[model samples]
Target: MVESILGYSPVLRHCFRNVSGKQFPRFQVIKAQAMELAKEPGLCKEKERYRDSLVGLKPGSWPPKNRADNPSLYNPLARQERMGCGWLGAIFEWEGVLKEDHPDLEKQSWLALAEEEGRSPPPGFVVKRIACMKNEQAISEVLCWSRDSSQLKRMALRKEDIHQALQGGVYRFRDGSREFVNVLTRHKIPVALVSTRPRKNLEEAIGAIGIEGVFSVVVTGDDVYRGKPDPEMFVYAAQLLQFIPERCIVFGNSNLTIEAAHDAKMKCVAVASKHPVYELTAADLVVRRLDELSVVDLKNLADIELTEFGSTPELEMDVEEEEDDRRPPSSAAIGDGFW
Candidate 1:
């Protein structure tokens, strides 16, 4: 009410006075009601709904197991704890774990692509950063190349062509890769091959390497949109093998593979192919060669030792009070700097 108008009417002034203040009982009650309603889950600002959207299957996919409709492969044993190759799977990486890896060829491929596309050549660290990424993913995400699907496809193909022409069509297994694969086969363990290579290229390489029938399942870059350090490849490989990630072991050659495998809820054995064994300490087990591992080793790795609290707790102390360097490598350290 205006002061001049309120002076003329005392009753009207008294009623309208202090109406904008929160001293009223009804105003306090309304404030309390709003505070209570804000506590509702939908109104909560902090809590996130990541579990249902991330766990098990993708958003709209069906349940992984349909035991009622589909017959199960391995019958459940009556033991308290199960142990055997009957249900375990071995997932191997192609370029490094099975066949020897040549980091030079990889770097060279990128350099050749850069030269052909008139882009600046990626430095050594940049090359290392994208070592585990698929060609198109590296082109778009890391190298800042054209995001157009057609251009990415063309450049990725051209890079592969350069790599193939430089490396030739030869496929040689690393020192003990064949022996380790045979051991798994003899034990009747299903083997899976996962790689960033395209399906056709990987199939041709397997054929050339004389191990066309070895892999029970092969997951290539074509099967997934992204590559390491995303867990999609390993997770999808586990699914294709009809085995839980816990029952599968991933054998890879770098910290990226170890990170991806762990994210997929699988144990990983890092092979010291292009990387040194000491540098791969993040893996469940690091071996100079695949043959260095035995059936018992794999079994122990597959059966993760969990604590009463569900997860294995980190130790309060480091190895003999030494610096803790066993942490996994991070790809994010490369930032968004262009090559």
Candidate 2:
């Protein structure tokens, strides 16, 4: 209603000025201010002379009754003083990003499962392929195990048991992980954790690590039908965090994680824990430790704006130019990007 009289762009720009240099404002603040500004005369002849239903209501009493027909006026990007400056969420991977799993433990678990089932041992490549997959998903999809739900459940539970025995029930944080988590919490950014591990095991591990209340959302294998390389877990995490998929930054340590994050339309920061820096070229940013990054780095990663075509306008233009020139464009054509 307010936008109909005073142009939307102009009114929201005014709201941005009023809320500048502070955290993003609630929709009510912008709506209330826009409605108040619309009431003054000389603003495009007061179209319809029909004030917003919200006008003249007490400041404390918001959301006039019977607003079923009213359209939503909230725009997350518009509320930002700048791109990525508003409320953003963080999603973290469990094994490689936050805690370091022992070398060969993953492969050993698969081998043990195969032996218990009287099957051939899985190769190293197979282990890596299923690194981010839930046990049942990997067993049925990659390993050609029986798809019966009861058998899948029994096999998945046994695999976790073998993994637990190999892991010795120990948990350890990666270098600088705990401190970085604390910094995000102190800055009021919501954090989420995603993993293919069972929720009961993950929650127990988190409790043992002494960071019980740190993560605002936790997504585990039990919560999803599939795992990484599918984007289901990351998407669910963003939904629970109440942030748009584009507003979430995923912290992970493998190419699989990077693939899943990009599939979910989220920015990814690859932690080069096991992989070398050159191998993680697909990530938006690569760092050796979590503390090496600050909030500014996260904001920069999420600063990208997408066109209706689902990619940045500059990228879209480059693709058009590539088609016009009948050749692949140089990497620098997009940006002087390291990845």
**lDDT (0 to 1) per candidate:** 0.76, 0.78
The global Cα lDDT (0 to 1) of model 1 is: 0.76
Q: How many backbone clashes does candidate 1 have?
A: 0
TM-score of each: 0.68, 0.68
Q: Candidate 2, residues 1-339: lDDT per residue as tens digits? A: 323322234224432324357644334454575466545543333322325544666776632232111124366444443233556899999998899866599899899999999988988989988988899989999998788999999999999889888888789999999889988988888999998989888998898788898889999999999887889999999999867777789998889889989999889999999899999999999999999999898877765464412323335656864575655444342232411
Candidate 1 off by > 4 Å: 1-86, 304-339
What tens-digit string does per-residue lDDT give for candidate 1 at 247-266?
88999989999999999988
Lowest-lDDT window of 10 residues in candidate 2? 62-71
List runs of model 2 lying over 4 Å from the truth: 1-84, 304-339
